[model samples]
Every structure is written in C-alpha cells, then in structure tokens.
Target: MFRVDIREMLVEAQPQMIITNDNLNARVDAQVYLKVRADEDNVKASVYNVANYKLQIVNLARTTLRNIIGTLTLKSANSERGRINEELRHTLLSETASWGIEILRTELKEIDPPEDVQITMNKVVKAENEKVAAVDFATATETQADGQRRAEIKKAEGTKQARILEAEGQALAIQLVNEAAEKYFIGNAQVLRKLEAVERALVQNAKVVIPADTQLINVIGELAGVAPIPLVPKAAASPPDRK
Candidate 1:
C-alpha cells in the first residue's frame, strides 16, 4: 500500500523584484510551513501533483511576493513585512489548494533595499533623530530660561517688599516719636528737642559754647539733676581808644 505523509513541511524562498510604487529594486526572503490535505479527493490530487507541487508552490510564492511587493513602495514593503508575508501566504494557498496544500504559517526572513536606498534611509533616520533632539533641547532651554526669569522676578519683588517694609517701619517710628513728644512734652517740645541736640553735641565733643543770655545751669540741671555753676560776667572794656 502507498502512503503519503501529510505532515507540515517548511519551505523558504528569496525573491527580488522592483516596486511599482517607486520602481525601486528590493529583495525579501520568506519561509512557509504547509501540509497536504488528508481527504480522499485531495489525496488523489496530491498523488498526481505532489511531485511537482513543491516547485509549483515555490514559483507561485515568488510570483505572489513580486506582485504584492511590486505594488508597494520599498518603505511600505520593509515596514509591513508581516502583512506582506500573510498576503503572500494567502495568495499562494488559493492557488495551491488545487494541489491539496494547506498553508500553516508564513514569515518574511529579511528585506533588503538597494545600497543607495539603504544609505538614504539611514540618512533620513539620522536627520529625524537630530530634529527630535534639537526640539527637545530647545524646549529644555526655554523652560530653564523661563525658570530663571521667574526667579529673578521673584527676587526683585522680594527686595522691593523688604525695602517697602523697612521704609514703613522707619515712618512708623518717626510718627510714634512725634506722637510721644506731643503727648508728653506739651508746648515745651522745642525746648526738649534743643536739650537733645545739646546732649548729642556734648557726646561728640568736649567743649561747648553757651549763649550769653541762655541759662546753661537750668538746661544742665533739667537733664542731669546736677547743681548749676554760676558764670561771672566780664568787666566792661574802657571806652574804645580815643577815636
């Protein structure tokens, strides 16, 4: 009795073609796993075509790959390898069904563009990466500049607030001093101010001149609680020498 092993088998092929979208030549290596159908009708066809089925399926797979890839640009074909493999497998299964073959799995192993195209693609990728990096760097710089600007603004505001608070404190102190003087010294505030001035002047220097009509002892006595020392008036000078 003749027996056929309907177990799945692995088939691999490399196809090279020009893409219709860009007229760019490309190559792709693919692999497919398939098995023969075990039904009596399909087995009969397999018996008749199985010898040539492998070659037919390989040729069909190559042609389908070319047709599908030819319709797509090199970029799309490279990026959508899974889709291409699935499409190729489906197309091959439809045609190979007459040979009682069932496609179990399909995969594209490698896709290669022309050397010039590869170089151009690499340049494109590099340029895109550089553009993204430049954008990120510019954004970061702007953020840092904004932070610095805000910090400077905050510092300036803080300085202004501090100066305003200090000025307010000084004004309040002056107001309080004036109020105290008005309340406690009554109309003699001017006399009290003069006494303060004299006190300051004495602290700065040892010698002081007293006005002729002023009572130094009274002023000193009021501030220091000390006994006053009387001053002697000078004798009148003889009438100016004869004219």
Candidate 2:
C-alpha cells in the first residue's frame, strides 16, 4: 500500500530581489496555500504527472512572481497587492491544471522598496501631514477671530441701546416737570419768581431789605394761604396834644 498525503499545504516564497517595470529593485515575499485532489484519478496524477510536486511548485511560484513583478512598477506592486495575489493564484491554477493540485489562495507578505525610495516616500507623507495641520490651524484661528469680532459688535450694540434708553428716560422726566409747573403755576408766575429770588439771596447769604409800603407781605400771605394783616395809619401825634 502506497501512502500520499492529500491535504492542504503551505508554501512560503522567500524574499528575493526583483526588478520592477520601472527599473526599481524591490524585495518581495509571499505565501501560497495548495492541496492535492482527493479523487483516485487525480491522486494518481499527483504522484506520476509530476515528481516532487512541492519543490516544483516552489520553483514555479518564484518564476511566476518574477514575471508578474516585472510587469508592474514598484509603486504599483506595493499599492495593488490584492491584484498581485489574485493574479499569482490564477496563474498557478492554470499551470497546475493537469498536476491534480488546487491553488487555494495566495498572499503577498512584503513588498519593500530600496532605502532611498523608502526615505522619499516617508518624506512625502510627512509633508502632506504638515500641510493638513497648517490648514487646520489657520481655519481655527480664523474662526476664533470671527467669534471675537461678533462679541465686540454685540457689546457695542448693547452700550448704544442702554444710552438710548437713559436719554429717553431723562427727556420724559423733564417733560413731566414742565407739565406739572404749567398746571399749577398758571397765574402765580410772579409769586414763583419772587420765591426764586428769595431762594438765591438765601443761598448767597445776602442781606435783603423790603419797603413797608410794598405788597410782599400780602403775596407771602397768599402763597401760605393765610389772611393778610391790616396796616393801620397812626393819627398825627394827636396835634401835639393841643397844649
């Protein structure tokens, strides 16, 4: 009885230097999963159609990867990894159709560029990040300035409104005083004028003299709502007593 292991196997394509379509060299590695068909006819073919199928598959994988990589630039090889993996598996499946092997899946492990290329790519990424940060900072500054401007405008508007209200209140108070004076002091303007003169004299501490024949006493009596006193004339000395 002969024994053949009809199970899935894993193969690692060792990292090797390959020239890309753009003449740039890169180190590439991959992994492939494959299995032998379990049917009797295909099982026989797995043993007889190819000797040492594992080693043959490895060599085939290397050659296929070189060909595929040769067709792509280094940048494309790094960016379009999924496309490369799919293409590798499809090619393997087609080449091994008669070998009773199934190409299950393939994965690219690494696609490393040269040192100088790597440095250039890193610098590019850093520059892009810095540009984005600068733009964000400028936008934030502009927003803050706009907010301050609006706040100042609001403050100024509030001050203007307050001033307007105060002026209106003062004008209303003056109008009310004038109205009260007009209602109460219709024919009493002379009385008010005399009162004002007295007030100014009192404030200045001035000495004031009133003539005996003036109606000042009567005016004062009227303002105070008091009866006027009658001034009696003295008879001429009783004619010297008619001695």
TM-score winner = 1
Candidate 2 residues lying further than 4 Å off, grouped into runs, are 186-243
| TM-score, model 2 to reference | 0.74
The CA lDDT at 218 in model 1 is 70
Which whole-number lDDT from 0 to 100 does residue 225 have in model 2? Answer: 87
lDDT of 1 at 61: 79
Q: Provide the TM-score for each candidate, comma-separated.
A: 0.78, 0.74
Q: Which model scores highest in lDDT?
A: 2
* Candidate 2, residue 186: how far the Cα is off, in Å: 4.8
Give me the overall lDDT of model 2. 0.85
- Give the alpha carbon lDDT tens digit for every residue of 1-243 in model 2: 657888899988788999999998899998889999999988888889999888888888889999999999988998999999999999999989999989899999998989998999999999999999999999999999999999999999999999999999999988985675576556778755765586578789999654453466665556568867787888776455564
lDDT of model 1, residue 11: 81
Residue 212 displacement (Å), model 2:
16
> Which residues of candidate 1, in runs, are more than 4 Å off?
1-3, 198-243
How far in Å is the alpha carbon of 183 misplaced in model 1?
A: 1.4
